[model samples]
Target: MSRIAVFGAGSWGTAFSIVLADAGNEVTIWGRREAVCADINDHHENRDYLPDVKLPDTVSATHDPVVAVDGADAVIFAVPSQSFRENLVDWAPVLPEVPLVSLMKGVELGSLKRMSEVIAEVTGAGEERIAVVSGPNLSKEIANREPAASVVACADEDVAKRLQAMCHATAFRPYTSVDVLGCELGGAYKNVVALAVGMAVGLGFGDNTTASVITRGLAETARLATRLGADPLTLMGLAGLGDLVATCSSPLSRNRTFGEKLGQGQTTEEIYASTRQVAEGAKSCASLLALAEKNDVDAPIAEHVDAVVAGRSTARDMMQAFIDRDTKAERD
Candidate 1:
């Protein structure tokens, strides 16, 4: 059995810890909140994120980051995209010469760095030793042991293989990729597009509108992914197109659900105040649009989502803007 340490006791972290434990690994999950830690230790539940889901008693919990990483063979950095850096700094002391894999999925603001790049910067880990797990994974579904698949990417083929071994499960299959940037970008950027699609649905737009946005959204994702040195095919895999469809259509996606609130006429302030989950797209939206503009890539759907979230226009106006976009080829 492997010694696995997971940072962040949120749903993804908790669910992943369960996956490892079920695979016969000794898993420890570190959480910042005392309440969350207590819940995991005492009741085997993460009430805040995955309520009513009982966890394995063998899956331990601690409030201290150091305890979590001590002597771990593999580390899963499962913190939210926004807070990953700061949390890694805390893990550096306890982390041995272990391989670090991230479960985060958003580009860093200002830096436009993929989650893998952020891992390299913060941990001084070689690209070969850093990897990421992402796909059309909806955590709640995975927690229920529903069948799922994801892509694990590393520049080094061996590292990708090792990650695939570590993460593969009866219900969760992981594909290997060398295009870390493409996988990361797809996982991150798709959330914004998912938000826009969900908002359109909430605004009473038909399936045709959703299909148009998703298809073009795939194009924009592949364009940026190729520009950033990822294989075009990876975007068509479980991490890219598949995830976008699921998140855009499902209520399980916090970003999509948040956008639905916006489309349903809730103010941004109201939505933010009403929900505690991290809707990563809200933070990533404008910054991604900025990055796309700098790269001279067209991402009108993402830009429209940003406008609605930032209060530059109502959701209805943003839809109108999409309708008024210049006619173009189906492939473009």
Candidate 2:
């Protein structure tokens, strides 16, 4: 039995810990707030992020990073993408040289670094030992023991297999892969597409409009993935299309909710002001736009969302722009 350290106490992190513990591994979670630790230890619930979900008692929470990772067989880095680097810096001394897996899905601002790269930079860990988990995973559904499959990708195939073992339950299935880059990038890029779909939905577009977005969104995602030396099929798998569909359709997805608020005529600042939950896509949108431009890739939906969020263009204006694009062959 492995002792798994989940380095973030957010909804997904907490739910993942429960999955691991249910799989018979010992799991501990670390959160920045002392109350979060108390909530899990005393009440078995992350009332702030995951209310009404009763976590198993086997999962413990702690404020000390050392206590969190002490003698753990492996760790999952589930921290917010923005503060991932900082947390790793703090975790460097406390965490053992165990294999690490990331649950983050965003390109780092300015550097456009992937989460695995950030993991290595912050922890001084080897690249091959790092891994990523991505797919159609919604915290609430997974916590409810709904059937779901996630891709566990790492440079080391054996590490991926190990993670798959730890992540597996009757309801939670993990598929192993040796393409961490594709899996991680697919997870990161899909959020931008989800935001676009949400905006289209909020603008009163019917099923046909949103359906077209999903198909073309896959095409655009594949183009970028291939340019980055990722296998095209990986984008078509659990981490890419699977994840995109789930994120776009689910009301629980923070990225979609963030975009819906924008479509409802709220400014980015105002939307954020109204919610205490962290919607990752807000930060990921601009960074993804920057990456698309830097790589000379065309990502119109992503670019427009970035503009809306940055206050350079209103959502209504962007919707008009989308409509003005020249008609072409569906796949052209």
Candidate 3:
């Protein structure tokens, strides 16, 4: 069995560890807190994040990064998109020569680099060695062994296939793709779109509005992806359309829930105080807006979401902005 290292004890990280173990891999997950590690080892449950799901026995946890990375055939980085750099820097010395898989979905603020790019820059790993796992992967559902499909993207076909084999379980089907940019962009921007859809939902807007937002948001994402040398069709794949549908529709999505709270007039501080999970969309929206600007792409939905999250605009104002836009061809 392949030995896998998952760095992060959050819901997604823990759930992925379970997937690997269920595929017959020996997995060791690394977390910051000693108590959380104890919980995974002693109880086989991450009560704080994934309350009801039980982990497989082959999945364990450690507070030590060295212990987690040792002898690992594949290293999965499931930490927050913002903190990936810091965590990888600390773990770089102990990182073995193995495929690095990113479970993060955010554009790095300031740099606007995707998670895979950040990993490459920090770890000095080549494109062939880095892969990204993304799709409608809601941690709780996956933890419950619900059927789900995701994309495993890398520049190297062989590496992607190897990773596909390692995480392929009956309940978790992974598709391999060489369109890493498409997969990465689709996963990252969908969170921003979900926020917009959530706001529409919170404001009591009907499916027509939500449907419009999702479609237009996807178009904007495709525009950006195409500009960045990605396959336009990837936006229609599991990493794109599939992921968007799941994140926007699910009550289990933290980003959507966070946006719903905002639409319902709760402050960011209030939401942050109540939850331990990181909503990557809230943090990634601004970065995405900046990237759109740099690339001269129009991303009105992402812009509005970023503005609302920054407290510079209100949901009502955002809706009006969409309504007031100059009439143009739908293709434009």
Q: Which candidate has the top score in TM-score?
A: 3
lDDT of 2 by residue, 252-291 (tens): 8988888888877788899888877777778888887787
Worst 10 residues of 3 by lDDT: 262-271
Alpha-carbon deviation at 154 in model 1, angstroms? 1.1
Instruction: Name the runs in model 3 displaced over 4 angstroms.
Output: none
Clashing pairs for predicted structure model 2, backbone only: none
**lDDT score of residue 42 within candidate 3:** 95
Error of 3 at 39 (Å): 0.4
* TM-score of predicted structure 3: 0.99
Judging by lDDT, tell me the better candidate of 2 and 3: 3
Candidate 3 residues 1-332, lDDT tens each? 98999999999999888889989999999999999999999999999989978899899999998899888999999999998898889999889889999999999998999999999999999999999998999999999999999999999999999999999997999999999999999999999999888888888898999899899989999999999999988899999999999999888999889988888888778888988899999999999999999999998988999999989988888988999999999989
Q: Provide the lDDT at 329 for model 1.
A: 83
Taken over the whole model, the C-alpha lDDT of each candidate is 0.85, 0.86, 0.93
Better of 1 and 2 by lDDT: 2
TM-score order of candidates, top first: 3, 2, 1
lDDT of prediction 2: 0.86
lDDT per residue as tens, model 1, 250-293: 88999888888888998889988987788888889887888888
